[model samples]
Target: MTFVVVQNSNNDTMTRRELHQAWGTQKEKLKLKFAALTDTDLLYPEGMETEMISKLALKLGKTKEEVYQIIKAI
Candidate 1:
């Protein structure tokens, strides 16, 4: 699948669409990456990327950047 990359205010390069797409395609891998994460945790509400990051950060004990990197890697 194709992805569009965008730079955020902090100059972090992330693929917003691809992040969600990868979450769909790589759910099992992500669960392995963050054992504490659940299926509900992966759900992405529209325009709730920050909320998703916060949830993941809390669940995974990771920084937002780290979570973003993990998602980007997927």
Candidate 2:
């Protein structure tokens, strides 16, 4: 799979569409990485990368930075 990095105003980089697509393809991997995460937890909205990170952080009990790191690594 290919990813196109998009930089937000806060300078955090993410591939919004690609990341969402990755979630679909990598659902099982994500579940393995974060057992507590569910399909609901993986939902991504357009242009809401920060919100997605925040939601993931809350659900996974990680910091926003940590969530972003995980997403980047994926």
Candidate 3:
């Protein structure tokens, strides 16, 4: 099962699908950004930071693996 949460400008929450769609967009962007880096680049801490990846996982209320798979599909 999948779950999602969305907050509107007025702080109203959206449905799971709605939040997932929004996360899908962000995951696509993250995929692009992640793919643009070289393996070496990803290895270096100062350059390709994985912090945002972690943060994104938390922000989207999804697991790291879930976010990772999303990025892969994009």
Candidate 4:
């Protein structure tokens, strides 16, 4: 549960990682959520917008997959 947290002028917070191990815990949670989703859900055309992805990442707690999809769509 060791994470780096930063506060921005806009009153937002985030973690800064210099290594993969720092993200391991969150990554595992995302992996479990991904595995639990049905194929239909996964293929349901997640909106590939950076803003949308960021919003969903904050709301649903997703990780790189959605970000990758958004980049791919771009």
> Local error of candidate 4 at 34, Å?
1.9
Report the C-alpha lDDT of model 2 over 17-49, residue by residue, as the tens digit: 776767666666677888888888777665666
Residue range 1-74, candidate 1, lDDT tens digits: 44656454567776667566556766677888767778998888655778888898888888888877677667
> Ten residues in a row with the worst lDDT in model 1?
1-10
**Would you list the C-alpha lDDT of every candidate in the order shown?**
0.73, 0.72, 0.48, 0.41
TM agreement with the true structure for every prediction: 0.72, 0.67, 0.36, 0.28
- CA RMSD of all predictions: 3.5, 4.2, 11.3, 11.3
lDDT of 3 by residue, 1-74 (tens): 44444333344444455434455365446546656433332222322224544665666677756655555445
Which residue segments of model 4 deviate by more than 4 Å? 1-10, 18-21, 36-74
Candidate 1 global Cα RMSD? 3.5
Rank candidates, TM-score, best first.
1, 2, 3, 4
Q: What is the lDDT of residue 53 in candidate 3?
A: 45
Ranking by lDDT: 1, 2, 3, 4
Off by over 4 Å in 3: 1-46
TM-score of model 1 (CA atoms): 0.72
Pitting candidate 2 against candidate 3, the one with the higher TM-score is: 2
Residue 66 Cα positional deviation in candidate 4, in Å, after optimal superposition: 9.7
